[model samples]
Target: MTTRIDDTALLIARALIAALFVAGAVQKAVDPGAAQGLLAGLGLPQVLVWPALVFNALAALALLIGVAVRPVAFALAGYCAATSFFHLIPSDPWQMSIFVKNWAIAGGCLALAVAGAGRYVVTRQRKL
Candidate 1:
């Protein structure tokens, strides 16, 4: 069915988006000092680094496993937008590219939130 195929496609897209965050979380966990330094440079407190790492990991897992998709996607969208403005801007070409990429990712998250993980999600919220 066309709907079934579309749902599968959405599942794949969710997984791919989650993968990027998971990989980034792994990198941050592996080299937390670097993450801390970067966060500190952004004028964030050092204590917040670990929480951010944990949030990233949890959000990525939720996205990948198709649980609470809409809220998780929305939250990640906010994160992406916030980071793009706070951390990625006012930098070199590489960071500019990342800024643009974050916005694009945020846009995808917004779309996913609206789409509600299609039919591939663990649980579906029904209309009242």
Candidate 2:
């Protein structure tokens, strides 16, 4: 049995999920050295940080606005899974935990993609 409050719950969940990217973007903007170094360490171009930062910010806004939830959720799920590779460090429990967390976040995004944004979306799309 679902109530109107279920939509509210979805809204809150979307906001919370989006907040993860928001925080990451802000952290990168404030101190991009870490992200840049991470990229460099992985034999990737450090300049990728700019695009990643932009993507995170845009995705955060899209999620907050409840726009293109399915697409955004799917994209974020992939992003989460890809980034988890950086945290694959069994020697460091913290990094391993972060890796697990990233996978967990990806799972949440997958759920959102499957379930959709519900009635709290800012722009409603025609349901097929």
Candidate 3:
């Protein structure tokens, strides 16, 4: 059984992760052209722009609803890893900070992916 503190931590982590995805998706969706430019600048194919936006939006929804949490977390983690590699490999001061932040968030996503969310997640409750 999980303790209250554990539950609280999970909730906070979930919300923060969800918020990050939601914000990213919203930003991309709002300006897909910009997102495409970013992807192209990163040397990624322009075709990834729409898919990335859609994936982030869907992942955010999954996290918000605590549905398919592990898969969503895994997907987001992969995305973050790729993004970090693309943006941070150049080693600029700004990109370094973003890289650190992405890695931290990816760590949280990895925890959620492996641990299967937590006591407060819908998946946990649904199991009962």
Candidate 4:
């Protein structure tokens, strides 16, 4: 049925999104100093580094496991929005390109939040 196919597509999309989050989180976790520097470059306060690292890791884990996916998606979307706001503004064309990339990712996260992870998510089965 069409619904089943859509579910499969959503599952794949969710997995991909999870992978992105996990990779980013892992990178930050493995190199806190580097992550902090990156955040600082984005104009974020130093106090934000640890929280961002922890939240990113936690959010990625939750997404990977499909647990509380709606909220996770919402949070991720918010995170992306905040990043876009801070880092995506007042940049040259080259930097603007990277900012646009974050916009696209933020759009995807917003879609996930709105769609509630589709039928393939554990949250749908009340597993989380």
Candidate 5:
């Protein structure tokens, strides 16, 4: 049985996660040069920025629509974990906060993957 609270929590989680990635995509779209520079600084090839931007946008859209929620959540969780180690993690305490937050976000995604999309999602998982 699905509780009201569970449905609400899942919706909120999906929305928040989608919004974060969408915002990131918008930032990358608005300042491609800066995005490329940042990626290059992290030792990533600048050419990868365009594809990453598209991936973020598409993944955000998928999350928002709640289609293929589990797989998307797992992929985003991995992406977040990777970005935390490469882009966010730093020696300074202030910078470490962002790193910690990325891991927290990844943890949330992992939870979402395990929980599925609840009753509110568009896509329904089949029971075996």
Candidate 6:
């Protein structure tokens, strides 16, 4: 049911979405002290930051390369929504904006989940 432009649009969307995850991973990697402290303050284990770093890096690459995009997008959607809580403090305009953006990203991921990666993926998707 999709046209070529739809597939191309999906490809571009995937890249843009993946870029966000890449930036997140890089930020944590480059500044673990801050990331670790933030997680610790949230009553999460500081050690959890490293695994998160790995997940973000791998997931970003997988999404960017269009590998298992449906599953990855679903997972990322959940991840985005869950992490959004960290920025849910409405008193801070900056945090509120991030929380809203995370929800928007989650919505986009859900769309990708429904649409799949289309034809331009590392593993070509069959028209269904």
The lDDT leader among the candidates is 2
Which ranges in model 4 have alpha carbons more than 4 Å from their true place?
41-44, 89-94, 123-128
Across 52-117, the per-residue lDDT of candidate 5 in tens digits comes to 889899988888888888999999999888777644545677658867888999999999999878
Candidate 6: stretches off by over 4 Å: 124-128
lDDT of 6 by residue, 1-128 (tens): 78999999999999999999999999999998877876877898899888889988998899888899999999999999988887888899998999999999999999999999987877665898
lDDT of each: 0.84, 0.92, 0.80, 0.73, 0.85, 0.90
Candidate 5 residue-wise lDDT at 77 = 94
> What value does the lDDT take at residue 42 in candidate 1?
86
Please report the TM-score between candidate 6 and the true structure: 0.91
Model 6 lowest lDDT segment of ten = 117-126
State the RMSD for candidate 2.
3.3
**36-94 per-residue lDDT for model 4 (tens digits):** 76668876766676787678778877776667878888888878777765455454776
**Model 3: lowest-lDDT 10 consecutive positions:** 119-128
Q: Residue-wise lDDT of candidate 2 within 1-128, one digit each (tens)?
A: 44679888888989999999999999999999999988988999999999999999999899899899999999999999999998898999999999999999999999989878878777656899
Over 1-128, each residue of candidate 3 has an lDDT whose tens digit, in order, gives 77788877777788889899888889887877877876788777888877887888888888876788888899889889878765665658887888888888898899988866576655443555
Choose 2 or 6, whichever is better by lDDT. 2
User: What TM-score do all the candidates reach, one by one?
Assistant: 0.86, 0.92, 0.83, 0.77, 0.85, 0.91
**Model 6 residue 98 lDDT score:** 92
As for candidate 2, its clashing pairs are none
Model 5 error, position 75 (Å): 0.4
